[model samples]
Target: MSGTFSALNAATTALWAQRRALDVAGQNIANVNTEGYSRQRADMQAIGGSAVPAFYSTSDGIGGGVSVEQVTRIRDAFLEGRGHTEHANYARLSTEAGALEQVETAFREPGDQGIQSLLADVWDGWEAVTNGPDTDATRAQVLQQMEALVGGLHFASASLKAQWNQTRENLTVLVDDVNAAAASIADLNQAIQRGNQTSLPVNSLVDQRDLLVMKLADQAGASVRHGKDGMVDVIVGGVTLVGGTSATKLAVAGSLDLAGTGTSPVRVVTAVGGHTVRPDGTAAGQLAAMNGIFPSYQSDLDALAKDFADAVNGVHTTGAYDKLGNPGIDVFESADGSPINASNIRVAFDDPALIAASGLPGAANTDSSKADEIAQLRSKAGGPDATYRRLVVQLGVEAAVANRGVQIQQVITTQIDASRESVAGVNLDEEMTNMLSYQHAYAAAGRLVSTIDEMLDVLINRTGRVGL
Candidate 1:
């Protein structure tokens, strides 16, 4: 009688275990399209008979039943860690490539309306003036061309400055995002810890936290360290952004504008101690563009502006004279009389009569030597034209390199993500197969229950009625 009851109990346990496994498969199928969800598995353990012997107790050495041991997510810790690192690298490269492309658009190199074309027009204007030194119309054309060149320089400088300021603003926003993610991670950490202590399911909570951790990795190059009780520490540049249930806030400090960057460079730092964080992801790329790339281009433009002004002014004020044969003054000056740069380079006087087109004093209307000399500057080995060409070439090469880096990093990131997905991502076909297996096992367990019940009925009712 005891053995027959034990058989029934074993069948009941099988039914329950199979039902739990089916439920897990169903959960996986339901979340097939859900982001950051890991596939779950229900582990089963066989229940054994008691080891101690007792009088009148039969021993068959057979298992009593099957039971669910635990439910766990199928995840690879090493793959997840690698995924975060590759994501950071991809974000940085993409950001830098985007910034470089923007800069290239601003320059408009090799195009009709670009600075190169404007510079060519200026040299042509000088040649026109050399052909008719006494002609006010030709001299006025020279002034217009110079104005165009100066305007081009100003536009280029302004674009760089604007991009720099925008990138700075973006950094502040990125820092805010990082802080928000850290706070959310800390909150989730506390919840997971509490759930773990009470032996409650915390898989969903862990998934949410992992997504936020990846966000931090992309935004700030944060890394994670697992801790006890289902908690994780988020670190950036060796500083913990989130430790257990506590989060550290971050701040952006220093330059607000590109003009001020020289004196006060931009930095990402901890909100409390002002410790700098040199991040490795998107923030790092923006910092590189703002602090190094944009500024270098601006400086190159400034150098070109100053050099062009100095060369033209030296020729114009020394040996040349205006139409009235008076000693020529400076032809280009800043509005504030400061040194000319890309931002403030302008024609000092608008009147064509003030232009010194003559090579000799008192022969202003006749001599074209000065105008010819200025026109010849276009072919000078180390002239403004050469400098501007060099800047354009450098920009093109850098932009190309940045774009290439983005492509390669993108390939790597995609491959890592694919590997991670294979490990943790749900598969509908596999889940359907598992569902069928669980269904058949459940049916078998039910059949066993029915058979055991029939046997018990025969022993209790039919056996006593035999031969009555």
Candidate 2:
């Protein structure tokens, strides 16, 4: 009687166990396409195996129904580390590409009518002045050409300054986002570590933390480590930021003035709990761009300006017309709106008629000397044009190299993620197969119960009636 009862209990347990398996399979299938969700599975074991009575006192015994041991997610830590590493590399290259793009915009070499063309036209104007010397209208034409040339220089210089300024502004904005990401990651690390210490599964928190880490790496490079207690620690550029359940706060100071010298130089400060931590190369990506590229371009512009003015003023000061145009006089102003050289200019005409009639030599000197000066000005413009053109070519090369780096990292990361899915991600086709198997087993358990009931009915009624 006890044996018969055990069979009924075992079959019942089998039905429940198979249902649990089916439920787990259904969950996996439903979440297959879900982002950041790892595949879940049920671990099974035989129930009452140790307590099952041995037949004939031998070791062999009737197996009891199954019991679920535990549920778990399939995950690999090494792969996650690799993914984050590649993400940071991609980010660095992306930043460089953007800065290069801005440089390309400033110069726009090889365009329909870029600085190179403008410089050529200036040369042609100078040649005309040189051939026909004493025509006032011709010299006036030369002055107009000089004015046009100056206009072009001012435009290009202002445009480059604006681009550089915008880069700094953008860096200030992205630093906020980077700090946010780091904070979330640190908080999640604390929650996960707590859960692990208490022997509770922190699956969801772990997932969230992993996602945040990925985002952080995309903003900057980080070195991630896992402590023995299942907590995460992150370091960047030799500065330790997050350690287990504790986090170091990050602050970025954005203070690069438009002139390229910092009214205040931008800096990154790190603090753990209340203690200050050392700051290092933590400023990556566009932040690095603002700190690095934009300033470089600004310096280049200043150099170009100084060179252009020096070359033009050098030739202009060497000669004079009927009215005086002496050396070491004001020729160009700095970008800050300051005059180049003040207080050295004076009219050299002795005759009141010449002084009154000519007004100024460089004002529109029709003398043959003015034509020679115009020719010299043409040379000055050409130097800067050549220099800027060289810079354009270098920028192009940088862009191509940086772009290639981004593409390579992207491809590698995508392939690695796919491989991870193959091992840990859920598949609906496999789940459906599991569903069918569990359903069939459940039906078999129900049939066993029905068979036992029918046997009981025959024994109680039909056998007894034959005796009567």
Best by TM-score: 1
Clash pairs detected, candidate 1:
none
What tens digits encode model 2's per-residue C-alpha lDDT throughout 1-55? Answer: 5566667878888888888888888878887777877877777788654554466
- The alpha-carbon root-mean-square deviation between model 2 and the true structure, to one decimal in Å, is 5.7
**How many clashes (backbone atoms < 3 Å, residues ≥3 apart in a chain or on different chains) does model 2 have?**
0
Residue 73 lDDT in model 1?
Answer: 86
lDDT of each: 0.89, 0.63
Give me the overall lDDT of model 1: 0.89
TM-scores for all candidates: the values are 0.97, 0.78
Write model 1 residue lDDT over 1-468, tens digit each, in one string: 888888889999999999999999999989999989999999999999978869977577887999998889888999989988999999998888888877877677878778899989998999999889878999999999999988888888888888888898899999999998999999999999999999999998999999898888898888999999989999887799999999999999988888777888898999999999889899988988888888888888889999999988998888788889887889889866777899998999999988888867784458888888889989999998999899889889998998888889889999999999998999898999999999999999999999998998889889988789
Give candidate 1's error at residue 429 in angstroms: 1.1
Which is the leading candidate under lDDT?
1
Candidate 1's C-alpha runs over 4 A off are: 54-59
